[model samples]
Target: MSQYVEQGYTAFADHYGSSEIIFGQFRRSRQNTQRIVGATKWCVFRPTNPTRVVVEAAVQERLDRMQTDCIDLLQFHWQDYNDKGYLTALRHLQDLQQEGRITTLGLCNFDAIRTDEICCQLGPGSIVSNQVQFSLIDTRPLHGMADVCQRHNVRLLTYGTLCGGFLADQWLGQPEPDAYSGRLTPSQRKYLDMIVKAWGDWTLFQSLLVVLRQIGDRHGGVSIANVATRWVLDYPCVGAVIIGARLGVSEHRGDNSRVFTFQLTQEDNAAIDAVLEQSNGRHLITAIGDCGAEYR
Candidate 1:
């Protein structure tokens, strides 16, 4: 559920910085305003593979647009597995850290194997997070990522936790769209359709909704996206879920924060487990290709 726009990195960063000023306009119009959430950094992961000097300049530019003196977390967008000079990029970031320009380092869309390689090579010079997609539907990380992060002490930042709003109750009883709206990319819709089919059609999805609603009612009203995000938060090394804000289009801040409001009970967990039992794993673990596979 990550967006890859090669040309406007600087502008995008600036727009997001200024987004807070205008969020209210849209929140009132289209978004749900029941959730309370907090400040989170949106790290850009790219394979422009800029030279260290260019990257350093670009990072500075982003900081300027963001109007922030320090980036709480700066995550590299992608890695060129064959080229292997990301070490140089990490070194540059480490130098920035010494200057107090960046507070923490992170990696986006990188697999466990490459993450270990980087850690072994750099010995922890500002690295702290590894952001990747992790859904109940796509539990590939459980195959090895959890153990790797434990050993290396790297926090994993999970994105697509809500699968671009496809994992919500809105779709439960509704007729399938000729194509889904509200998604910005074809890839996003593609995954939503995948989830629909994988989750056992519209009918079974309605059943899942009944379960989520029951859980929500017990917890004082949590949305399906909130539930999915909380589930991700329960995973090992998952510091947070990276949900898209879709500035000026929707505002889920309040609903998203219900994650902190109510704790999921053993009964709740068991309830979720019960629904998952009915899951048919037809589309479960095939490769979406690599990490951030949707973007590429």
Candidate 2:
């Protein structure tokens, strides 16, 4: 945490764990010298009535867990679109925001339709961001979410930008790993399925790695992961890319920092698009449903 703060990274997102542990470590590391932006998610997967009391309690729980009077950003995640309780929850959250309990409100894994509807119902600036899966392999956001975000001024916090590390140089010329093998991490399994069944086959994915590698070489031998991240960050609607890291176990602070050193050229984009044009990138919106459809 101290190293991250030293590197000028202030934003931290937490969910489904001991937020107090993380928040306390952050505070101690920061030493109150720099502002730490803490973002957390409240996921309501099951159908339930979100009464005023229920919603307020939920917000208060997060505040208490984080040891803060107000949450920097509270992202809501709803599993079922059939239920209208999410709207009620958001309304309560908005009321809490008005009362200064939350600085900003956002959504998690919401499809473009709901995102548009919520923004319209809540009015402009009610929602500030949406977290979703977006990468060269999964370009579902481009189908509709990007347009809705642009219309409503909602930035996208993208995950899967590195395709579970498959976009790295280590996988450049490697053969596909067995899905059932115990070696693959959970994220690797999920994204590997997306690549083979939804996005493209292994051969096609190798082609993408080749293109990314070439682009990396052109940009002063940056890693393939750097090129992949740079592609997602280049999008106008993307506010940040959420790259998973194992704190103390492994870190990519130096490699990731290189993503900001250079911009992809029109030629670089063309090369990437050429490979993407042959894949099922466009059909993923329907194949996997919308941005958060997989979870639903």
Candidate 3:
């Protein structure tokens, strides 16, 4: 984010995990977002503990460090699905909203099943969005995630749309990743390797890249990353794709922005699937594991 600030892009960081764990450079990040993005807040996470006061005070302490009167986006990072209290958290969040401390509410890493439960439990207010992984490589959200958001009137803010920078021109025609390319963590590499196999092997991915290159040609130049993002945008209720900013590295501001310019044709969409449909079904839900579960 410091590098993002240097590059003059508005830098807002999402804070997740337990209240006791520090997520980001809270104070400085808040100041930077405010300066660059017009009004911004340091995002705060919901706690695992059921004590409403502890969670409320934790959020308040984050607000105090941010030097902001209100948080712009506060998200429950995950639902305690088998827990003693989900409403206990929501009631306090509703309280915070009524108190004007939190301007917007969101959920992260939650699937459609739990989203329905949240809507049924709390019946809605201030829930502007839900964050999920939606990429060509990971299509679990399309199965039911999109439908639930439509029902609840909640939007999806996505991550992993670019698959940690693998969906790019740089990777096209490259050697199949070796054992030590740093392309993915060892475990993640195993998972994604299975994903590639599902997408019909290296020979087929190269063909897809050929199609992407042809499509990119029509737009003067576009990244496969853009096509991957376009696939996500086609789904209902997707508000934005939170492309990760590798903070000290150079920026792809232009590449990232071009995603909005070109539209994909039915043929283009079919071309992407032509490769995928013929392939074996590794079914990433099982191969790649659940949301945040792989990391665990």
Top model by lDDT, which number?
Answer: 2
TM-score of each: 0.75, 0.97, 0.80
RMSD of each: 7.7, 1.1, 4.5
lDDT of 1 at 284: 51
- Per-residue lDDT value at 269 in model 1: 83
lDDT of 3 by residue, 1-296 (tens): 44455544553645433321222344344553355321222233343665778668857866765566677677675444566365577668778878998877777776677777787677755466787777766676766677788888988888877766666787788877764767555544754564566444767666766777777876667888788788789777898788776444746876777788889888888877876665553376666555444443
Query: Which candidate, 2 or 3, has the higher TM-score?
Result: 2
* Model 2, span 1-296: residue lDDT tens: 77887897778887756865577556755546678888999899888799999899988988878878888999999898999888989999999999999999999999999999999999999999999999999999999999999999999999989888888998888989998889788999999999999998999999999999999999999999999999999888999999887788657888988998999999999999999999989998888899999987
Clashes of each: 7, 0, 0
Tens digits of lDDT, candidate 1, 1-296: 01111111111221355553333222234333343221223343455555667668857864664456666566775535665667777778778877888877777777777888888887854568787878755655665667778878888777667666767877657765655465336646766575566545656656766777788878777787777777778877787666665655765655666777777788978988787667653235454444555565
**By descending TM-score, how would the candidates be arranged?**
2, 3, 1
Q: What is the Å distance of residue 133 in model 1 from its true position?
A: 1.7
Residue 192 displacement (Å), model 2: 0.5
Lowest-sum lDDT 10-residue window in model 3: 36-45
lDDT ranking of the models: 2, 3, 1
lDDT of 3 at 46: 40
User: Worst ten-residue run, lDDT, model 2?
Assistant: 24-33
